[model samples]
Target: MKKTLIAVAVMAASGIAFAASNVTLYGVIEEGVVLEKAKHGDTTVDLRSGFDQGSRWGIKGTEDLGNGYSVGFILEQGFNVDSGDEATSGKAFSREAFMYVNGGFGKLGFGRTGALSFAQSNAILTGWAFGTGYGLSSWTSAIGNNFSRMDNVVSYATPVFDGFSVHAMYSNGLTGDSEKWSDNNHYYGIGVKYQANAIRSSLIFEAADNKGTATADTLVSDVLTENQWNALKQTPAWSTVKDDVVKAGTAKKKALYVINYGFEYNLGSWTPMFAYQFAHQNQGRRTHMFGLSAKADVAGGNVMIGARYLFGKDKATKVGASELSVDGDVRAWNIGAAYVYPLSKRTALKAFAGYADSGKEWKNVEAVGYNGYQVYLGMRHSF
Candidate 1:
């Protein structure tokens, strides 16, 4: 079934690319039988949904703008393989949409893009090969270090020199109130990475000041309608989903910061990797995570074993409202292995099995119940 679907997708994509090769329409549609059993406070069944690799389809185009510069644009839409859901129930362009110009000097971009924190992770923490059963692996834990693909953002990335570079983004919060003292919501981040024949390393930092006078209630349930969302110069809703619960303060969480550090080392016969991330929410709450992963070739196939630990506390004091409560530890672990054998250049067979365990304490608060073991088989084809 996966093969048939891939063939159909390839044919459909080929028809569109038949006209020109300059534009590339490519994406990953990974779906299979995912059996989930949540037995903590309650027992239920939600056979399929995208929690690992997000199901998405994207179209990208680039044009030679001359003068050592080129302009490119990307429009992406996410779909669910299980129920064929679009992004989040009904968003047409839910994944991402952005435009940028690349040249000799640097890269200037506008629209929505991942934050610097996203780029600051180590290869092992990047979740590059973390699909399938490795749900609780280091890659999955790194999701917290991620940032919103900001909207109405003007970003500039400097050319790398000697394995080092930086990026700065400025967002204009048009809806932000003036009397609230929400200044220009600007963010700056810098990362320097060293990659050689056998090793790669990176460090990155991202910081933001709320400077917005938006009400705390909206910030908690901040997501407005999509049409209303797009009107602002740059709205915070782009990052926080409609259902994602937020706790707003009189000052808002406008002033937030996150930092991530990662590294990977390869030793011809085997390789190892490590990463650490820390996030501070305003002046009250904070969370930190550390992950380490590595595997080696055995019996002509690669095997991986990895783990991540996260500890966090959330605090908000209100006049009438009460403080949020959580107990036990906030930690999840996943260990899995996958073996791939090539049938052809673009075809391969993949089989993976994994076991993941998370805190049962927060089960009631979380939508997706925690703690279980999962196994799956997948086939991938590319053209």
Candidate 2:
């Protein structure tokens, strides 16, 4: 009987190979032409891609190991088409690079992949790109998703049952203290999502206090000033900020908490979405963001509208530790609309424009409060 089962499995693998491949190649190329004017006297056309959905090319392969078991891996490369350079500096395999084994219980893998908070954040996205930097998940994915798919990591996912399942990840700290650590510089997230028909909902929770380089912004100043592309490196001013942030961690003996909650319902030609985001770090400084989004089909095209609100820490500590509020509160908002037409099956013609405003405040008031706006038009293609 065992021999018969083995023969049947080999046949199944062969059949699948003929239908599809044990290997695959896929990719997307996106570009955005943006013009902006800021209070800091910055005006220029920033041609971009990989900023929204991230542009990349990748290859993946899968193989049946045997009875209810399989294995697979992915190698992806991200790049910016405008400058013909690597995305996020020349970080090889920056996206996803992992190998996994599947079975009736679930699947286990190692390498880089998604984090709990990052996964939960999809709860709020309106299907639009995240280009504006976690605008949707401003509160939930605050620490950013990188900590989820970090290097030297292991993960596992349970088999889906009734549209519900769980996923978890752990990163091994090959460096730093906590040599006595079990999940040092490590983080974990668990989320539950349900999809029946026209309704969808997601709830996720995560915690981690990574002790190393946390997420930082892009080096726009470096790129624009030098007229060259440079990885967004953290500035010295950020050093102080980072220090405060670390206090939200364990090694630094600090922690940051964030949450994102959202839902959507399909209504024939449109689906409306609403989300709330919140983040609090160390001794009470807090930030909150909320967004409303909707999609509709009109005259053989798709239309989208999105608006967001951000409120930084109040003039007072509202939550965590004390004596932690430094820069005071920063508020921002953006409103935009886009119309996209399907030129062909693989190509799309899109024209979008939007306005963004930022309200900044310095605890000392002697410092400058920053404000800015932007306008953009762009197109994209994929292969």
Candidate 3:
């Protein structure tokens, strides 16, 4: 049973790092068998558990604290090896829990990590492989979202020069409500990368905020008035009482912004990737995405392909008093592929597939019943 669940998670991370004398324990365990299909609907099949990656377990500790300093910690989590669930629910090291301090002007951490522009835009659109395009490759759901993993952060990294490096982050939100903390809300990000030798590049920028306001059924769903337009046709329970008077209104701020750019190049065995992303909001929504990936080596192992495109705008709303509007130009396209072989050096065996579509006012409104497809086959190991 997956090596008895990795020997009971390495004996519960060596009994919680037996008093921590530089602990260490790692993990990975993938499971697969998927099928999916959706768009016109009906197909289904399952058994996927972190398909190509992301079934995890982790632990690491450090201590030294001498002139060169040191002190670290990390506890990671992610699961569902078929049905253990908890890919993050009630947080038990949901992904990572941090604490660090290092020297030479680099490394500094706090809690809940990730979000230096989602790890430099997923390592420049996955040139930093794992499960193809960001694990379990399915063309990364057409590259969107991401920029999560943050919860009162405060990170920093730097100490690579010549090959370039930099990262920064911030978060506040701190909801202990000092009268709603302010700065609108809070979150921040910054990134830079270089890597050299085979070329690599990255850039990131992020932001988040959002205050409060607008209620009254969200301003009568965004513009109605005159007693919410005479209580919207007076039926449907007064349109559910103007959406419960716009969810009991009062909140406004809405801020979000992002910018990312990536690049990669190699050769020899081939490698190429590119990325571009933009997402904006202040309350006008906007999105954009573009990606391309490639990897090669063939037969013995390795092969990946990817593509993506997206465009967006959304606000729409409006279902009884009319007024709010926007959604009319969003698009999508995706493609995916994967292969892997190995079977040693920690196991492997893989396959992947993906598809996506949209265009024509985002047919089916995206990922939900949007033209879809997926395929899987898996096995992966690591310890």
What TM-score, over all chains together, does every model reach? 0.70, 0.70, 0.30
**Sort order, lDDT high to low:** 3, 2, 1
Query: In model 3, where is the ten-residue run with the lowest total lDDT?
Result: 212-221
Instruction: Assess each prediction's global lDDT (C-alpha) against the native.
Output: 0.52, 0.53, 0.63
Q: Which residues of candidate 2, in runs, are more than 4 Å off?
A: 1-21, 117-149, 173-184, 212-253, 312-327, 360-370
Tens-digit per-residue lDDT, 1-383, candidate 3: 45445545676866832444466667888888888675656688888787656788886667787898797888788888888978865568776778878889988887776676443112323333332333323323433644555556778878889998887777674211222454223677777888879988878787765433243123222454333443354557744554334334555535667787777788879788777778877555577877777788997899878777778864545412224344557677767788889889998888887777766555654242236778888888888
Score residue 118 of candidate 2 by CA lDDT: 51
Screening candidate 1 with a backbone cut-off below 3 angstroms (N, C-alpha, C), the clashing residue pairs are 182-211, 210-254, 210-255, 220-246
Clashes of each: 4, 11, 10
What is the lDDT, from 0 to 100, of the residue 265 in candidate 2?
A: 80
lDDT of each residue in 7-45, candidate 2, tens digit only: 345547768432323666667787777666544455767
Per-residue lDDT of model 1, residues 1-383, tens digit only: 45434544665776843232246666665554544443333433344434444567776667787888888777777787778768644445565667888899888877655565442111112322342234434243322444544445667777777756555665554222222233334455555556656767767676766444233323321344434534432556635542232222344564567777777778876678777778776544467776667767766656666666666754433211222254333554445565665566655555555555555333333222134455555555444
Distance from true location, Cα of 281 in model 2, Å? 1.8
Query: Model 2 — TM-score against the truth?
Result: 0.70
